[model samples]
Target chain A: MSTEISIQRSVKPLGKDELAALVARDIAPGSFVNLGIGQPTLVSNYLTEEQNITLHTENGMLGMGPEAVGEQIDGDLINAGKIPVTELPGASYFHHADSFAIMRGGHLDICVLGAFQVSATGDLANWHTGAPDAIPAVGGAMDLATGAKDVFVMMTLLTRDGTSKLVEACTYPLTGVGCVTRVYTDKAVFLIGPDGVTVRETFGITLEELQQLVPVPLKATSAVGV
Target chain B: MLQFIDTVGEAVAGIRDGSTVMIGGFGNAGQPFELIDALLDSGATDLTVVNNNAGQGDQGLALLIKEGRVRKMICSFPRQSDSWHFDEKYRAGKIELELVPQGNLAERIRAAGAGIGGFFTPTGYGTMLAEGKETRFLDGKWQVFETPIHADVALIKALTADRKGNLVYRKTARNFGPIMAAAAKHTIVQVSEIVPTGALDPENIVTPGIYVNSIVRVAGTPAERAA
Candidate 1:
């Protein structure tokens, strides 16, 4: 397991399916959740029907399944990301206001989102990068991060250029402040709290190795290989 | 009272220049394409358009902007892979954009229909979006005040509507239609089917006739309507 996790800088990153499976392993049963647009959308595919966890898309569909296959794609069955997906049993359609009301009203138990960077203090910066040409893509992220009972981010620990996403402060325009609760990265899982970001689990590396690799110094805890 | 209008041109004729209009859709799913075409032909200019996206293709609201009809846009998802029109015009500073958090955008529009002045939301509390807006920590959370977005006119699409203007939306494509209908002064709905009064099941009606102003019939079967 340790050798398998030794990622070369030039090697391809872990596919979203493996990351989704990792995120899905910890979700409690009977929780209503919303998966964010990108990598977070894959989390729904890993959940079992037995979990009884309901999925909501902000564009007005609840009880969605994985993305629809080739012929199964329906133009009208798009999720919030505008990607086609299948619906589970007892699926329902709603108006935009009511759907967002469910989001902002804090009915979701958890929201899995993809982030550009997360601060040590749980602030999130996903809407815009620190670039002039970057369009502000503040879709439903602000609402999801702040409104959900818990916010879990799924992303790589490092950017493609090897910059650590776990930082002292995020430079990108914030989607919300102190809203993130947990982070599921390709390398490890972090719990963001008032004290700061802490490692809950790592893929196969020790806390010392991860600390050396990242930009920020780690408050090394009993990092388990979960 | 029957509110089904004669044609798309007739329904869009009341739209004046500089009117703030809410067009319903998440992308093109529930877009009122025909009404937009008519609005384009009518030469209405300086229009403030509000919706979820900044339009996708060369036609529709994007076309309205390409023709320089739109002065401003209030939307949540302002960029898409194919949203070149918005990207170009916005970069050129020719068109203005007010990016809203999607939930806040929906709630503001909902607030208008519900007759609420404004509300506080935890979203955008400490972000750049909260700058200049009144904010406070309430119940152990930071919140920002969002005002209602009341549009002068609303152009929406529905799956089926009765002559009395009661609307029933399709599966997931029903994004902003009902709420936009409620938040605007005049709501013109384009539905694939127009049934007689009391024909649609009352239990299934999403937007009651009281909120809707008029309905336009689009040529498509009920099955195709949901497609």
Candidate 2:
């Protein structure tokens, strides 16, 4: 079945920073958040000082700050992406086991990740392209996907070839099953649950256009508007 | 009692061929480069190495992998911009890879240290990584059973070590040091400073003396340079 969502309909789709700001705005104050590498890392820039969010990096740190500058950079101080980073005032360091425990033990409130594909049922596939000759590297993607209280995905709505990343079912290898709670895309925002995928909002595109791009059926919510 | 050694060569001298070695690092942060170089010099091959990554640029673990010393890599992320050596070896079928989820890798190493047999985790449930593993519905979620990863030798880097072998680390460089120190039969550490027993505060000791077997002072580490 299809439903219509009164879209924001921006002249241009929400840019990377805009999407990050949207995600940051939705995060509850005082939440513990983990931003995955790549695009998800941009979300941290939109998080305001008033938000009081504690950042967790799976490489054994909590209260992680922004990327370090020249004098602040240290080989010993880096995030999961191996980029040198600074620590917040209340930062604490632990071993790898304890760091992963923070994720796997359900201590993290929210985590934003980038995905290759997100199924209607919320299955996530981001780690491996499943290419035969490619060396597969599954970092903390699976752990963060399955372990967080709420998993939000950030990505462009379609691949470079214009194929929808939101699908009826993920064709690539699964990182975690039914783990994604919300999807923040350049074209739209989707909420995935047991009932079905819901179009929370659309950007620079109508609900009809979004449906044409996505293979899965969508139900729209008029909770948000431009 | 922790033996204080002078040379990196003597620190990693006991690692034999065909042993499972856990190298402590999350990238180059806490990697014991001197110990790895010593292992390379000692001509120990056929090693099953465990770390968060396979290797990065052409140094340390990358150098060893380039020299065909590692037979298998048990790690989470092996593909990186500078991981050409691992990529080439893996593509040529000269090396084997066991890619575990990051949290599972860390927890398994911890289980080995904590003397736990096995534990169930929901991290990789219903994913390719959990295939063929035992599954159970516990705590209202499907969890996969994972076993411990014990190491024959562990080479780690720490910021400082006391006469009693208590160790402290620098920031995120503490990644796998404390856990790897306990998970291995013999743990060798390279530290910037070797202080008197009471020099390190009791409350701040990350790894106690019991987990450390040998300690070597590496004079020119970044920690020392900064100090």
Candidate 3:
């Protein structure tokens, strides 16, 4: 007896900012979120206050706001990166221990982190390159990855060399396994599925063309023209 | 009854060379200096040290690195301070370093204490960190594989402790102490004071005695270790 196989078509990609907005829409009101350092940190500026989201920093502040103007900056009140920041009303200070408890105890609803490579299986590898000269720091990315209820990866879709950051499997040392739930990229957003990476939507490109852009083999199916 | 040793040198007597040790504190805020000094005097080499930060400029764990005792270090940021030893040795390829993101380091230790083998994360995707590891997709995004971390001994500090070994830390000193206590096979705590067992309230205890194997009370402040 012969067995039949089926393939699915790919989806389009979204711009970096557009993907950020998409992630913002997914966050529920009153949710506790951790915006990781670098690009993921930019998501804080776009979160609508109506959502009532409470931002947390590993450095011991909660109910954090985006970076403030020079005059408004408080030298003592800063985030984990030591960047000057503003605190929203109802904010309180706690021991750094409590701040980490909120993270390690899995109390956070969402954690958005920048990425180096996202695999088809949703593996993360953002810290330590094994480079002899590199400083070798993992920061707080590891905790946020494993502790958050949901994780969203924010990064460019491809490297400068045109290589896709999303792959069939990660080749670098892992930070967490199967912790990511969604991916938002400059070109497109892909959902890592048991069947493989399934494209949810795209920004300016088409499905057929996206297949050519991605390094991993696309599961071909019907046309998903957008 | 809990016996308080006269000096830190007598407290760390059983620790041998090539032992895996977890040190407490974030940056240099709450390190166990007395215990570190004793470990140094013991001349234990080939040590695998785990901590949040390596301590500023050869003052804390840097002393170990300088003595050529440390074979490897697993931490979040090793050079967050002005430590010449880390830069000089790391540059010379003398020390093996595994850098864990701060949060992940905490979780990995906690996971080991909680009896979990491995957990998932999405922190390192698309960077050099994703070069060689297993990955999986959950919900819709990418997450990487991060294994648990554990140690053979934990050298920790506490603001206060009762004779029963219930610990309390002041401010940032509590950084990795509680979790380190849980992750290590044997935890030796150095504290400023050791009060009666019932003196510490259950609510205020940071690390329960169940996780601590021994307690040593320092006579002087962490700064007086040299004297």
Compute DockQ for each candidate against the true complex.
0.63, 0.62, 0.16
The C-alpha TM-scores of every prediction are 0.93, 0.96, 0.64
Q: In angstroms, what RMSD does candidate 2 have relative to the true structure?
A: 3.8
State each model's CA lDDT, in order: 0.84, 0.91, 0.74
lDDT of 1 by residue, B70-179 (tens): 99999998888989898899998999999998989999999999999999888888888889999878878878999999999999988888877899887777889888
lDDT of 3: 0.74
> Which rank order by TM-score, best down to worst?
2, 1, 3
Q: Quick one: best DockQ, which candidate?
A: 1
lDDT of 3 by residue, B1-227 (tens): 33456677877787888998998866554578778888999888899999876656656688888889899989877765486788778889899988766765776798887788997755555445556878888656676677888898898887788878788875434667887888988888888788987999898777888888788887655323321
Question: Highest TM-score, which number?
Answer: 2
lDDT of 1 by residue, A56-120 (tens): 98899888877889888777788888887889888999988888788778898899999899988
Q: Lowest-lDDT window of 10 residues in candidate 3 chain A?
A: A1-10
Pairs in clash, predicted candidate 1: none
Q: Candidate 2, residues B151-190: lDDT per residue as tens digits?
A: 9999999999999999999998899999999999999999
Clashes of 2: 0
